[model samples]
Target: MSFSTNQARIRCTQLAPRIGDGPGNLAQIETELASAASDGIDLLVLPELATSGYSLTPSEARDAALPADSPVFARWQAILGEHTSAVIGFCEHGGEDPSGVLIYNSAVILTPGSAPTIYRKLHLWDTEKSIFTPGSDVPPVVDTPFGKLGTVICYDLEFPEMPRSLALRGADVIAVPTNWPYISRPENEHAPEVVHAMAAARASGVAIACCDRSGEERGTVWTEGTTVVGTDGWVTGEMAASGRYDAAVELAGDRRRISPRNDVFGDRRPEFYEL
Candidate 1:
Protein backbone atom coordinates (compact mmCIF):
# COMPACT_ATOMS: atom_id res chain seq x y z
CA MET A 1 0.00 0.00 0.00
CA SER A 2 1.08 3.60 -0.64
CA PHE A 3 1.94 5.94 2.21
CA SER A 4 -0.99 7.80 3.74
CA THR A 5 1.13 10.96 3.79
CA ASN A 6 4.29 12.15 2.09
CA GLN A 7 5.89 13.92 5.02
CA ALA A 8 6.58 12.43 8.46
CA ARG A 9 8.06 13.85 11.65
CA ILE A 10 10.60 11.36 12.98
CA ARG A 11 12.58 11.41 16.22
CA CYS A 12 15.42 9.26 17.47
CA THR A 13 15.82 9.30 21.26
CA GLN A 14 19.40 8.53 22.33
CA LEU A 15 18.75 7.03 25.75
CA ALA A 16 21.28 5.56 28.14
CA PRO A 17 19.66 2.45 29.58
CA ARG A 18 21.30 0.96 32.62
CA ILE A 19 22.35 -2.62 32.12
CA GLY A 20 19.96 -5.30 33.50
CA ASP A 21 17.49 -2.71 34.82
CA GLY A 22 14.37 -3.85 33.02
CA PRO A 23 11.87 -2.00 35.18
CA GLY A 24 13.84 1.25 35.18
CA ASN A 25 14.37 1.03 31.42
CA LEU A 26 10.69 0.42 30.86
CA ALA A 27 9.93 3.54 32.88
CA GLN A 28 12.37 5.51 30.76
CA ILE A 29 10.74 4.26 27.56
CA GLU A 30 7.28 5.06 28.90
CA THR A 31 8.29 8.65 29.58
CA GLU A 32 9.68 9.05 26.06
CA LEU A 33 6.59 7.54 24.51
CA ALA A 34 4.29 9.87 26.42
CA SER A 35 6.39 12.89 25.42
CA ALA A 36 6.50 11.83 21.77
CA ALA A 37 2.76 11.31 21.74
CA SER A 38 2.20 14.75 23.25
CA ASP A 39 4.54 16.34 20.68
CA GLY A 40 2.84 14.49 17.81
CA ILE A 41 5.85 12.55 16.64
CA ASP A 42 4.90 10.30 13.73
CA LEU A 43 7.69 7.87 14.47
CA LEU A 44 9.97 7.54 17.50
CA VAL A 45 12.99 5.25 17.32
CA LEU A 46 14.79 4.17 20.47
CA PRO A 47 18.23 2.61 20.94
CA GLU A 48 18.98 -1.11 20.67
CA LEU A 49 18.23 -3.13 23.79
CA ALA A 50 16.37 -0.14 25.22
CA THR A 51 14.57 -2.47 27.58
CA SER A 52 17.61 -4.26 29.02
CA GLY A 53 20.68 -2.25 28.01
CA TYR A 54 23.82 -3.62 26.35
CA SER A 55 26.94 -5.37 27.75
CA LEU A 56 24.98 -8.01 29.62
CA THR A 57 26.28 -11.40 30.65
CA PRO A 58 24.39 -14.37 29.20
CA SER A 59 22.59 -14.94 32.51
CA GLU A 60 21.73 -11.25 32.75
CA ALA A 61 20.36 -11.30 29.21
CA ARG A 62 18.17 -14.27 30.08
CA ASP A 63 16.98 -12.50 33.17
CA ALA A 64 16.03 -9.45 31.10
CA ALA A 65 14.43 -11.08 28.07
CA LEU A 66 10.74 -10.44 27.41
CA PRO A 67 8.47 -12.41 25.16
CA ALA A 68 6.98 -10.76 22.08
CA ASP A 69 3.56 -10.91 23.69
CA SER A 70 4.64 -9.13 26.85
CA PRO A 71 2.06 -6.83 28.45
CA VAL A 72 4.58 -3.98 28.42
CA PHE A 73 3.87 -3.50 24.71
CA ALA A 74 0.18 -3.04 25.40
CA ARG A 75 1.11 -0.31 27.87
CA TRP A 76 3.30 1.35 25.27
CA GLN A 77 0.50 1.08 22.72
CA ALA A 78 -1.78 2.90 25.11
CA ILE A 79 0.64 5.83 25.25
CA LEU A 80 0.92 6.25 21.49
CA GLY A 81 -1.24 8.82 19.77
CA GLU A 82 -3.52 7.62 16.98
CA HIS A 83 -1.03 8.89 14.44
CA THR A 84 2.09 8.05 16.38
CA SER A 85 4.18 4.89 16.05
CA ALA A 86 7.33 3.64 17.77
CA VAL A 87 10.15 1.20 17.09
CA ILE A 88 12.04 0.07 20.16
CA GLY A 89 14.61 -2.64 20.81
CA PHE A 90 14.37 -5.37 23.45
CA CYS A 91 15.89 -8.68 24.44
CA GLU A 92 13.40 -11.19 23.07
CA HIS A 93 12.89 -14.34 25.11
CA GLY A 94 11.21 -16.66 22.61
CA GLY A 95 12.92 -18.10 19.53
CA GLU A 96 12.58 -21.01 17.11
CA ASP A 97 15.89 -22.50 18.26
CA PRO A 98 15.43 -26.13 19.20
CA SER A 99 18.23 -26.30 21.71
CA GLY A 100 16.57 -24.19 24.37
CA VAL A 101 14.90 -20.85 25.10
CA LEU A 102 17.24 -18.73 23.00
CA ILE A 103 17.10 -14.96 23.06
CA TYR A 104 17.33 -12.69 20.03
CA ASN A 105 18.11 -9.02 19.53
CA SER A 106 14.72 -7.77 18.33
CA ALA A 107 12.85 -4.56 17.58
CA VAL A 108 9.09 -4.18 17.84
CA ILE A 109 6.88 -1.71 16.01
CA LEU A 110 4.02 -0.50 18.15
CA THR A 111 1.13 1.40 16.57
CA PRO A 112 -2.11 2.47 18.15
CA GLY A 113 -4.95 -0.07 17.81
CA SER A 114 -2.69 -2.63 16.18
CA ALA A 115 -0.81 -5.67 17.36
CA PRO A 116 2.94 -5.32 17.78
CA THR A 117 5.13 -6.32 14.84
CA ILE A 118 8.49 -7.76 15.85
CA TYR A 119 11.62 -8.17 13.73
CA ARG A 120 14.44 -10.24 15.14
CA LYS A 121 17.94 -9.07 14.29
CA LEU A 122 19.14 -11.01 11.28
CA HIS A 123 22.83 -10.15 11.55
CA LEU A 124 24.35 -10.46 15.01
CA TRP A 125 27.34 -8.22 15.83
CA ASP A 126 30.58 -9.09 17.71
CA THR A 127 29.74 -10.28 21.23
CA GLU A 128 26.11 -10.49 20.13
CA LYS A 129 27.05 -13.74 18.41
CA SER A 130 27.48 -15.18 21.87
CA ILE A 131 24.26 -13.59 23.17
CA PHE A 132 21.57 -13.73 20.47
CA THR A 133 20.54 -16.35 17.98
CA PRO A 134 20.52 -14.95 14.43
CA GLY A 135 17.03 -14.57 12.97
CA SER A 136 16.32 -16.74 9.98
CA ASP A 137 13.45 -14.67 8.61
CA VAL A 138 13.94 -11.45 6.65
CA PRO A 139 13.10 -8.06 8.14
CA PRO A 140 9.50 -6.90 7.81
CA VAL A 141 8.09 -3.81 6.06
CA VAL A 142 5.16 -2.63 8.19
CA ASP A 143 2.34 -0.33 7.24
CA THR A 144 1.93 2.76 9.38
CA PRO A 145 0.00 6.01 9.22
CA PHE A 146 3.16 7.99 8.50
CA GLY A 147 4.63 5.64 5.88
CA LYS A 148 5.85 2.14 5.13
CA LEU A 149 8.13 1.48 8.08
CA GLY A 150 10.93 -1.09 8.05
CA THR A 151 13.16 -2.13 10.95
CA VAL A 152 16.69 -3.50 11.52
CA ILE A 153 18.94 -3.83 14.54
CA CYS A 154 22.51 -2.43 15.08
CA TYR A 155 24.69 -4.45 12.74
CA ASP A 156 22.01 -5.20 10.15
CA LEU A 157 22.43 -1.74 8.57
CA GLU A 158 26.11 -2.46 7.91
CA PHE A 159 25.00 -4.99 5.32
CA PRO A 160 24.07 -3.11 2.13
CA GLU A 161 21.72 -5.88 1.08
CA MET A 162 19.58 -5.44 4.20
CA PRO A 163 18.46 -1.87 3.42
CA ARG A 164 18.30 -2.53 -0.31
CA SER A 165 15.98 -5.47 0.23
CA LEU A 166 13.71 -3.31 2.38
CA ALA A 167 13.67 -0.57 -0.25
CA LEU A 168 12.94 -3.07 -2.96
CA ARG A 169 10.08 -4.36 -0.82
CA GLY A 170 8.61 -0.81 -0.76
CA ALA A 171 9.85 0.63 2.52
CA ASP A 172 9.68 4.41 2.81
CA VAL A 173 11.64 4.63 6.04
CA ILE A 174 14.07 2.29 7.76
CA ALA A 175 14.07 2.67 11.56
CA VAL A 176 17.36 1.40 13.00
CA PRO A 177 17.64 0.75 16.75
CA THR A 178 21.36 0.54 17.42
CA ASN A 179 24.02 0.51 20.15
CA TRP A 180 27.28 1.60 18.58
CA PRO A 181 30.41 1.18 20.75
CA TYR A 182 32.66 4.17 20.27
CA ILE A 183 35.31 3.84 17.59
CA SER A 184 37.84 6.63 17.35
CA ARG A 185 37.95 8.48 14.06
CA PRO A 186 39.21 11.76 12.55
CA GLU A 187 38.16 14.82 14.55
CA ASN A 188 35.77 16.13 11.88
CA GLU A 189 34.55 12.97 10.24
CA HIS A 190 31.22 11.35 11.01
CA ALA A 191 31.37 8.04 12.88
CA PRO A 192 32.07 5.24 10.41
CA GLU A 193 28.64 3.73 11.20
CA VAL A 194 26.89 6.98 10.31
CA VAL A 195 28.81 7.02 7.03
CA HIS A 196 27.46 3.54 6.26
CA ALA A 197 23.90 4.70 7.00
CA MET A 198 24.32 7.71 4.70
CA ALA A 199 25.57 5.52 1.88
CA ALA A 200 22.65 3.10 2.36
CA ALA A 201 20.09 5.91 2.33
CA ARG A 202 21.57 7.37 -0.83
CA ALA A 203 21.80 4.05 -2.63
CA SER A 204 18.19 3.13 -1.92
CA GLY A 205 16.61 6.61 -1.94
CA VAL A 206 15.00 5.74 1.40
CA ALA A 207 15.14 7.76 4.58
CA ILE A 208 17.07 6.14 7.49
CA ALA A 209 16.70 6.93 11.18
CA CYS A 210 19.35 5.33 13.38
CA CYS A 211 18.75 5.70 17.15
CA ASP A 212 22.05 5.04 18.88
CA ARG A 213 22.55 4.88 22.63
CA SER A 214 24.37 7.47 24.76
CA GLY A 215 26.69 7.39 27.81
CA GLU A 216 29.11 4.60 28.70
CA GLU A 217 28.17 1.01 29.49
CA ARG A 218 30.43 -1.61 31.05
CA GLY A 219 33.47 0.55 30.36
CA THR A 220 32.53 0.81 26.69
CA VAL A 221 31.90 4.35 25.45
CA TRP A 222 29.03 4.75 23.00
CA THR A 223 29.10 6.64 19.72
CA GLU A 224 25.85 8.45 20.67
CA GLY A 225 25.47 8.78 16.90
CA THR A 226 21.74 9.13 16.62
CA THR A 227 21.09 10.47 13.12
CA VAL A 228 18.32 10.95 10.53
CA VAL A 229 19.24 10.74 6.86
CA GLY A 230 16.85 12.08 4.26
CA THR A 231 16.17 10.41 0.93
CA ASP A 232 18.89 12.49 -0.72
CA GLY A 233 21.60 10.82 1.42
CA TRP A 234 22.53 13.77 3.66
CA VAL A 235 22.21 14.11 7.43
CA THR A 236 18.85 15.76 8.04
CA GLY A 237 18.82 15.91 11.83
CA GLU A 238 21.41 16.54 14.52
CA MET A 239 21.36 15.47 18.15
CA ALA A 240 19.78 18.14 20.28
CA ALA A 241 20.83 19.12 23.81
CA SER A 242 18.23 16.69 25.16
CA GLY A 243 19.79 13.81 23.20
CA ARG A 244 16.92 13.63 20.73
CA TYR A 245 17.38 13.99 16.97
CA ASP A 246 14.28 15.21 15.16
CA ALA A 247 13.64 15.64 11.45
CA ALA A 248 10.77 16.08 9.02
CA VAL A 249 11.44 13.64 6.19
CA GLU A 250 9.57 12.88 2.99
CA LEU A 251 8.26 9.35 2.59
CA ALA A 252 9.12 7.25 -0.46
CA GLY A 253 6.54 7.11 -3.23
CA ASP A 254 5.71 4.74 -6.09
CA ARG A 255 8.82 5.57 -8.00
CA ARG A 256 12.54 5.85 -7.23
CA ARG A 257 13.57 8.25 -9.96
CA ILE A 258 16.85 10.04 -9.24
CA SER A 259 17.28 11.73 -12.63
CA PRO A 260 15.39 12.16 -15.89
CA ARG A 261 16.69 8.91 -17.31
CA ASN A 262 17.54 6.80 -14.25
CA ASP A 263 15.55 5.16 -11.47
CA VAL A 264 17.03 3.55 -8.37
CA PHE A 265 14.84 0.45 -8.53
CA GLY A 266 13.84 0.26 -12.20
CA ASP A 267 17.49 0.33 -13.23
CA ARG A 268 18.40 -2.65 -11.09
CA ARG A 269 19.58 -5.71 -13.05
CA PRO A 270 19.57 -8.24 -10.24
CA GLU A 271 19.53 -11.20 -12.58
CA PHE A 272 22.96 -10.31 -13.92
CA TYR A 273 24.64 -9.92 -10.55
CA GLU A 274 25.16 -12.68 -7.96
CA LEU A 275 24.05 -11.34 -4.60
Candidate 2:
Protein backbone atom coordinates (compact mmCIF):
# COMPACT_ATOMS: atom_id res chain seq x y z
CA MET A 1 0.00 0.00 0.00
CA SER A 2 2.79 2.42 -0.86
CA PHE A 3 2.12 5.79 -2.44
CA SER A 4 3.70 6.79 -5.71
CA THR A 5 5.99 9.78 -6.13
CA ASN A 6 3.46 11.27 -8.53
CA GLN A 7 1.45 14.05 -6.94
CA ALA A 8 -2.19 13.42 -5.96
CA ARG A 9 -4.67 16.25 -5.72
CA ILE A 10 -7.65 16.34 -3.31
CA ARG A 11 -10.53 18.80 -2.95
CA CYS A 12 -13.02 19.24 -0.12
CA THR A 13 -15.97 21.27 1.18
CA GLN A 14 -17.03 22.73 4.53
CA LEU A 15 -20.80 22.40 4.16
CA ALA A 16 -23.23 24.41 6.33
CA PRO A 17 -26.81 23.28 6.07
CA ARG A 18 -29.36 24.53 8.58
CA ILE A 19 -30.02 22.21 11.53
CA GLY A 20 -32.33 19.36 10.47
CA ASP A 21 -32.26 20.88 7.01
CA GLY A 22 -32.20 17.80 4.76
CA PRO A 23 -33.39 19.41 1.49
CA GLY A 24 -30.82 22.15 1.72
CA ASN A 25 -28.22 19.53 2.60
CA LEU A 26 -28.96 17.48 -0.53
CA ALA A 27 -28.93 20.55 -2.77
CA GLN A 28 -25.65 21.82 -1.37
CA ILE A 29 -24.01 18.41 -1.63
CA GLU A 30 -25.17 17.97 -5.21
CA THR A 31 -23.89 21.40 -6.16
CA GLU A 32 -20.52 20.83 -4.49
CA LEU A 33 -20.14 17.41 -6.04
CA ALA A 34 -20.88 18.81 -9.47
CA SER A 35 -18.28 21.51 -8.98
CA ALA A 36 -15.67 19.05 -7.71
CA ALA A 37 -16.39 16.74 -10.60
CA SER A 38 -15.94 19.55 -13.09
CA ASP A 39 -12.61 20.43 -11.47
CA GLY A 40 -11.31 16.83 -11.85
CA ILE A 41 -10.48 16.21 -8.21
CA ASP A 42 -9.12 12.81 -7.28
CA LEU A 43 -10.67 12.79 -3.84
CA LEU A 44 -13.30 15.00 -2.24
CA VAL A 45 -13.66 15.13 1.54
CA LEU A 46 -16.76 16.58 3.22
CA PRO A 47 -17.89 17.62 6.73
CA GLU A 48 -19.22 15.35 9.45
CA LEU A 49 -22.95 14.97 10.11
CA ALA A 50 -23.15 16.66 6.72
CA THR A 51 -26.57 15.42 5.68
CA SER A 52 -28.38 16.28 8.89
CA GLY A 53 -27.35 19.62 10.33
CA TYR A 54 -25.28 19.54 13.55
CA SER A 55 -27.90 20.83 16.03
CA LEU A 56 -30.45 18.06 15.81
CA THR A 57 -31.77 16.55 19.02
CA PRO A 58 -31.14 12.84 19.50
CA SER A 59 -34.61 11.99 18.22
CA GLU A 60 -34.40 14.44 15.33
CA ALA A 61 -30.99 13.08 14.46
CA ARG A 62 -32.24 9.52 14.54
CA ASP A 63 -35.19 10.38 12.35
CA ALA A 64 -32.96 12.06 9.80
CA ALA A 65 -30.72 8.99 9.41
CA LEU A 66 -30.68 7.30 5.96
CA PRO A 67 -30.53 3.65 5.04
CA ALA A 68 -27.35 2.27 3.47
CA ASP A 69 -29.23 1.26 0.32
CA SER A 70 -31.31 4.39 0.13
CA PRO A 71 -31.69 6.59 -2.97
CA VAL A 72 -29.03 8.95 -1.60
CA PHE A 73 -26.48 6.15 -1.72
CA ALA A 74 -27.34 5.43 -5.36
CA ARG A 75 -26.97 9.09 -6.29
CA TRP A 76 -23.67 9.43 -4.45
CA GLN A 77 -22.41 6.19 -5.93
CA ALA A 78 -23.09 7.52 -9.40
CA ILE A 79 -21.42 10.80 -8.47
CA LEU A 80 -18.31 9.02 -7.24
CA GLY A 81 -18.14 6.77 -10.28
CA GLU A 82 -18.25 9.73 -12.62
CA HIS A 83 -16.51 12.53 -10.75
CA THR A 84 -14.26 11.61 -7.81
CA SER A 85 -13.82 9.37 -4.82
CA ALA A 86 -15.67 10.96 -1.89
CA VAL A 87 -16.00 10.64 1.85
CA ILE A 88 -19.57 11.48 2.83
CA GLY A 89 -20.99 11.73 6.35
CA PHE A 90 -24.39 10.49 7.49
CA CYS A 91 -25.88 8.90 10.62
CA GLU A 92 -25.85 5.09 10.23
CA HIS A 93 -27.54 2.33 12.19
CA GLY A 94 -25.61 -0.84 13.01
CA GLY A 95 -28.48 -3.22 13.54
CA GLU A 96 -30.81 -3.31 16.53
CA ASP A 97 -29.65 -3.41 20.15
CA PRO A 98 -31.63 -4.07 23.31
CA SER A 99 -31.08 -0.52 24.54
CA GLY A 100 -32.48 0.79 21.24
CA VAL A 101 -31.19 1.19 17.67
CA LEU A 102 -27.43 1.80 17.80
CA ILE A 103 -26.53 4.91 15.81
CA TYR A 104 -23.01 5.79 14.74
CA ASN A 105 -21.50 9.09 13.67
CA SER A 106 -20.31 7.48 10.48
CA ALA A 107 -18.49 8.42 7.27
CA VAL A 108 -18.88 6.28 4.18
CA ILE A 109 -15.97 5.92 1.78
CA LEU A 110 -17.51 6.23 -1.72
CA THR A 111 -15.43 4.77 -4.49
CA PRO A 112 -15.80 2.19 -7.25
CA GLY A 113 -16.49 -0.74 -4.99
CA SER A 114 -19.19 -3.19 -4.02
CA ALA A 115 -20.44 -0.45 -1.69
CA PRO A 116 -19.06 2.23 0.56
CA THR A 117 -17.35 1.01 3.76
CA ILE A 118 -18.75 2.90 6.70
CA TYR A 119 -16.23 4.04 9.30
CA ARG A 120 -17.92 4.84 12.60
CA LYS A 121 -16.57 7.78 14.56
CA LEU A 122 -14.56 6.38 17.48
CA HIS A 123 -14.23 9.51 19.62
CA LEU A 124 -17.51 11.13 20.60
CA TRP A 125 -18.06 14.75 21.66
CA ASP A 126 -19.73 15.66 25.00
CA THR A 127 -23.42 15.33 24.12
CA GLU A 128 -22.51 12.98 21.28
CA LYS A 129 -21.27 10.54 23.90
CA SER A 130 -24.90 10.00 24.82
CA ILE A 131 -26.18 9.83 21.23
CA PHE A 132 -23.81 7.46 19.47
CA THR A 133 -21.96 4.34 20.54
CA PRO A 134 -18.17 4.54 20.59
CA GLY A 135 -16.48 2.31 18.00
CA SER A 136 -13.98 -0.24 19.32
CA ASP A 137 -12.17 -1.42 16.20
CA VAL A 138 -9.17 0.31 14.65
CA PRO A 139 -9.83 1.42 11.04
CA PRO A 140 -7.63 0.07 8.27
CA VAL A 141 -5.89 2.22 5.70
CA VAL A 142 -7.62 1.52 2.41
CA ASP A 143 -5.96 1.94 -0.94
CA THR A 144 -7.39 4.77 -3.00
CA PRO A 145 -6.36 6.19 -6.38
CA PHE A 146 -4.24 8.76 -4.55
CA GLY A 147 -2.71 6.61 -1.80
CA LYS A 148 -3.38 4.64 1.34
CA LEU A 149 -6.04 6.69 3.13
CA GLY A 150 -8.03 6.52 6.36
CA THR A 151 -10.61 8.60 8.25
CA VAL A 152 -11.54 9.94 11.72
CA ILE A 153 -14.59 12.08 12.37
CA CYS A 154 -14.82 15.30 14.44
CA TYR A 155 -13.72 14.70 18.05
CA ASP A 156 -11.44 11.90 16.90
CA LEU A 157 -9.03 14.60 15.66
CA GLU A 158 -8.46 15.81 19.25
CA PHE A 159 -7.07 12.46 20.40
CA PRO A 160 -3.35 12.06 19.69
CA GLU A 161 -3.83 8.33 19.74
CA MET A 162 -6.22 8.26 16.77
CA PRO A 163 -4.03 9.67 13.96
CA ARG A 164 -0.92 8.13 15.49
CA SER A 165 -2.58 4.74 15.30
CA LEU A 166 -3.46 5.32 11.64
CA ALA A 167 0.06 6.49 10.81
CA LEU A 168 1.56 3.49 12.58
CA ARG A 169 -0.63 1.32 10.38
CA GLY A 170 0.74 3.14 7.28
CA ALA A 171 -1.81 5.73 6.22
CA ASP A 172 -0.58 8.41 3.81
CA VAL A 173 -3.45 10.81 4.48
CA ILE A 174 -5.86 11.11 7.40
CA ALA A 175 -9.19 12.61 6.38
CA VAL A 176 -11.35 14.17 9.07
CA PRO A 177 -14.96 15.29 8.70
CA THR A 178 -16.00 17.63 11.52
CA ASN A 179 -18.71 19.94 12.89
CA TRP A 180 -16.36 21.95 15.14
CA PRO A 181 -17.79 25.00 16.91
CA TYR A 182 -16.16 28.42 16.87
CA ILE A 183 -14.67 29.24 20.27
CA SER A 184 -13.47 32.85 20.62
CA ARG A 185 -13.55 33.26 24.40
CA PRO A 186 -10.48 34.80 26.09
CA GLU A 187 -9.60 31.66 28.06
CA ASN A 188 -9.66 29.59 24.84
CA GLU A 189 -8.33 32.40 22.66
CA HIS A 190 -6.40 30.50 20.04
CA ALA A 191 -8.08 28.42 17.36
CA PRO A 192 -7.98 25.22 19.42
CA GLU A 193 -9.25 23.03 16.60
CA VAL A 194 -6.58 24.12 14.12
CA VAL A 195 -3.87 23.96 16.80
CA HIS A 196 -4.88 20.43 17.79
CA ALA A 197 -4.91 19.33 14.14
CA MET A 198 -1.45 20.78 13.52
CA ALA A 199 -0.09 18.96 16.56
CA ALA A 200 -1.61 15.69 15.34
CA ALA A 201 -0.16 16.22 11.88
CA ARG A 202 3.36 16.62 13.29
CA ALA A 203 3.06 13.71 15.72
CA SER A 204 1.65 11.34 13.13
CA GLY A 205 3.87 12.49 10.26
CA VAL A 206 1.00 12.11 7.80
CA ALA A 207 -0.98 14.69 5.86
CA ILE A 208 -4.31 15.70 7.43
CA ALA A 209 -7.35 16.77 5.39
CA CYS A 210 -9.90 18.30 7.75
CA CYS A 211 -13.26 19.53 6.35
CA ASP A 212 -15.47 21.27 8.89
CA ARG A 213 -19.03 22.56 8.72
CA SER A 214 -19.40 26.33 8.46
CA GLY A 215 -21.99 29.13 8.94
CA GLU A 216 -24.82 29.21 11.51
CA GLU A 217 -26.65 25.93 11.91
CA ARG A 218 -29.48 26.28 14.40
CA GLY A 219 -27.79 28.51 17.01
CA THR A 220 -24.24 27.05 16.93
CA VAL A 221 -21.63 29.01 15.03
CA TRP A 222 -18.84 26.81 13.64
CA THR A 223 -15.24 27.67 12.81
CA GLU A 224 -15.60 27.38 9.07
CA GLY A 225 -12.21 26.23 7.92
CA THR A 226 -11.55 23.32 5.61
CA THR A 227 -7.80 22.77 5.88
CA VAL A 228 -4.97 20.56 4.68
CA VAL A 229 -1.85 20.12 6.85
CA GLY A 230 1.17 18.35 5.43
CA THR A 231 3.44 15.94 7.30
CA ASP A 232 5.73 18.87 8.14
CA GLY A 233 2.96 20.51 10.20
CA TRP A 234 2.38 23.31 7.74
CA VAL A 235 -0.98 24.68 6.65
CA THR A 236 -0.87 23.63 3.02
CA GLY A 237 -4.43 24.71 2.15
CA GLU A 238 -7.08 26.54 4.14
CA MET A 239 -10.62 27.98 3.89
CA ALA A 240 -10.92 29.43 7.41
CA ALA A 241 -14.17 31.36 7.36
CA SER A 242 -17.86 30.93 6.61
CA GLY A 243 -17.27 29.91 2.99
CA ARG A 244 -17.30 27.22 0.33
CA TYR A 245 -14.99 24.20 0.30
CA ASP A 246 -12.50 25.34 -2.30
CA ALA A 247 -9.15 24.06 -1.03
CA ALA A 248 -6.91 21.71 -3.03
CA VAL A 249 -3.68 20.03 -1.92
CA GLU A 250 -1.16 17.87 -3.67
CA LEU A 251 0.45 15.16 -1.49
CA ALA A 252 3.76 13.69 -2.61
CA GLY A 253 4.31 10.01 -2.01
CA ASP A 254 8.10 10.35 -1.85
CA ARG A 255 7.78 12.85 0.98
CA ARG A 256 5.44 10.59 2.94
CA ARG A 257 7.72 7.55 2.83
CA ILE A 258 9.58 6.92 6.10
CA SER A 259 13.21 5.87 6.27
CA PRO A 260 13.99 2.36 7.45
CA ARG A 261 16.52 3.73 9.94
CA ASN A 262 14.02 6.03 11.61
CA ASP A 263 11.50 4.62 14.07
CA VAL A 264 8.56 6.97 14.61
CA PHE A 265 5.85 4.81 16.16
CA GLY A 266 8.01 1.86 17.23
CA ASP A 267 9.75 4.03 19.84
CA ARG A 268 6.57 5.39 21.46
CA ARG A 269 6.41 5.03 25.25
CA PRO A 270 2.79 4.17 25.96
CA GLU A 271 3.36 2.36 29.27
CA PHE A 272 2.94 5.65 31.16
CA TYR A 273 -0.79 5.78 30.42
CA GLU A 274 -3.33 3.12 31.29
CA LEU A 275 -6.47 2.54 29.26
User: Who wins the TM-score comparison?
Assistant: 1
Cα lDDT of model 1 by residue, 58-153, tens digit: 889899999999998988998986878999999999854567779989999997777999999999888998988888888999989877889999
Question: What shift in Å separates residue 187 of candidate 2 from its native position after superposition?
Answer: 11
TM-score, predicted candidate 1 vs. hidden true structure: 0.95
lDDT of each: 0.90, 0.74
Weakest 10 consecutive residues of candidate 2 by summed lDDT: 240-249
| Candidate 2 segments whose C-alpha is farther than 4 A from its true place | 1-5, 185-190, 240-242, 246-250, 254-275
Q: Which candidate should be chosen as best, given lDDT against the real structure? A: 1
Candidate 1: clashing pairs of residues: none
